[model samples]
Target: MSTLPLLGAAMTVAELEGLQDFILSRDRDLELQDFCELGALDADWKPAAERAKALLQGYKGRLGIHGPFWGFTIASGDVEIQKVVTRRMRQGLEICDFLGATQMVIHSPYLTWDYNNLDNHPGRKAYQNFLDYTHATLDPVIAYAEKIGVTMVVENIMDKDPDIRRILVEDFNTKALAVSIDTGHAHYAHGSTGAPPVDYFVRRAGNSLQHIHLQDADGYADRHWNIGEGNISWAAVFRALGELTSNPRLILELRNKSGILPSVDWLKARGLAE
Candidate 1:
């Protein structure tokens, strides 16, 4: 019997209520998104975490969480800011531990501007500085992740150079770290920023790509539209994914949470996903 690929949705705690059966029917991967807000995590997270457990009862699937990403960058050069980012990310790890999640999505620090200018400084020192700051921020988190058996998948945001995140993950040289690609973000970069196409991002990341945010976009903003709603080449992207040895969690990250299953059906209809 052929094993089906890991496929699922990124949903908040409340969104799981109406979609639990649909999700469990698929019985694959899931990414909890409620813990990404710093204020909410600080105010109180136990209630939501408990509710998530209740809602996810009988769900036997790979679980992950979207870590804190608002109002801060993980690669902030400021020492104080780096400390705060580290703390918030640790809290995210706490949630992962509490929920037994084995994966957490962390946004990449690579920016579009850094692609051409990272070499501007003498001997590529600017890129080295970015790496230094990023490492300082993530090392602690990666250590805890390794201890708890979680893989920190760094997601690409405004990353124009696909090799950058892949190289960073390789530099970490730990199973605790991997790559994540957001199709909409890649498409936006391809059309709007002259970067390579979405499939190229998948191909570049190669086996290091452990998690993927599948969505559609008009090659403009991060629309996060449902699959087939925009212009992404689903067939080509899935073809590239089919070549990967890594069994990545293909999670549909749509703006409208209601579109999760419909998008799955869309992919299924096109024979791109099961």
Candidate 2:
């Protein structure tokens, strides 16, 4: 297998230094996943912005960006919600430009409101309507991303079906729009014995897998377990990746509150991070 690139989910500026330390001081393979604070846009966020930029410039590692999931709803049918989503998406893309982020990760809007519980689910007509609205709302944002040379990666969420990824990639009809497969979310939705039939997904996605968020989980729930702590077979996954020859950005989107460095260390000890 080709060398798999590693990355840390830098949800805060403080985490970037740790990532730098891991890659440089420890000789570990890693990159940085920038998780920008959308709420800080109105605040004096320039310092964080500068720090993020510095990490991108100094770290000698590939960069990826995760957009704010709480406030942004790119698929909202409501006009007001759509406006907010567009504004936030534009802001996030601008941040990506500054950070030189190759991919911008986005969460599909949660099922809310009256028709919210009905988006391409159960394969019904109402769900199809919801899908149409979502595609309509996201086209402008996708165009904007293309103009700036950024790939917009819509992620899978809890209770989301696997087919949605295929639907989005096929319907969007743009390289700028792609999928950020979140292993944790997929495990939460599917049984967590292993990945969500990733071999099938990889084939279905073809070249649309722009990025990946790797975390482990048990069949019971999505625990964001470190690389070796859960039922996942990293070696097997890497084996598939080798066959596919699609080395999408592999970001370690684990629970950083604890177990983050230990996970890196575990991979290092096994020569997985070399």
Candidate 3:
């Protein structure tokens, strides 16, 4: 029999009562990847952990957790800022343990204000500084992840190119340190610049892609619209996945602001579902 094709939804259940809705609606075999909302380094993460555990109790499908997004950076050049970000992310990791989440997604740091002074924005030294700091800081986190039995997957930014992404992957060589290829980010990275086509990233990352943040993108901003709401050629993407030796976990990374379920149904009607 063919391996059961798996699909995941990015939903955070930060309350015990929400499990009923999540389980009733979600597919029994499908994964549920949480988009944790612990944005700051405040001491409000205890409730987040409680909620994740309650919702995931006896959950039949796989579990993955997205680390906090707002005001957190793992690649900061400033040691104090990096320490705060690390503390915040460690809370998310603790939540992963509670929910039995095996995968966690994280973002790299942006440039410091000093970058504004550079003649070439995103200059070699600036990028090198970011990379140097990221590699050093993340080493401890990687060790912590292994100790806790979770793989931390780094995501692609909307402005990065395949070359930079290659460095991101090659610089931190490990199966646990994989890519979270965001579709909208791919369009943004390639649409404005004359970079290689988006698929170049997919093929280059190859088997190292642990998860995908699937969404359609207009020529401009990341619409986060459902499958065909924009111009993204998702059919081609699935076709490419079919050719791969193994497929990464396809996570529908759309906003949950109503209408998303319907759009998912629309994608299902178009044969995007397994």
Model 2 lDDT per residue over 42-119, tens place: 566557668867655555555656776675556666877777767777777777776666677888653323223564
lDDT of 2 at 111: 37
| Per-residue alpha-carbon lDDT of candidate 1 for residues 50-166, written as tens digits (9 for 90 to 100) | 999988888889999998899888789999999999998898899999999999999999889898789877897887787789899989888898999999899999999989999
**What is the overall TM-score of model 1 with all chains considered together?**
0.97
What lDDT does model 3 reach? 0.63
- Which residues of candidate 3, in runs, are more than 4 Å off? 1-4, 14-41, 110-128, 194-197, 257-260
Q: For candidate 3, lDDT tens digit of each residue in 1-274?
A: 3243445666645422443453445533223344454433355555655666665566666567777767656677788877776666677677667667777888745332332443365547766776777776677577677777777777776435554545666687765577767887777656754444556667766777777777777746767777677777766666666665645777777765344456557666667653
**Which whole-number lDDT from 0 to 100 does residue 96 have in model 3?**
69
Candidate 1 versus truth, CA RMSD in Å, comes to 1.3
Candidate 3 clashing pairs, residues 3+ apart or interchain: none
Best by lDDT: 1
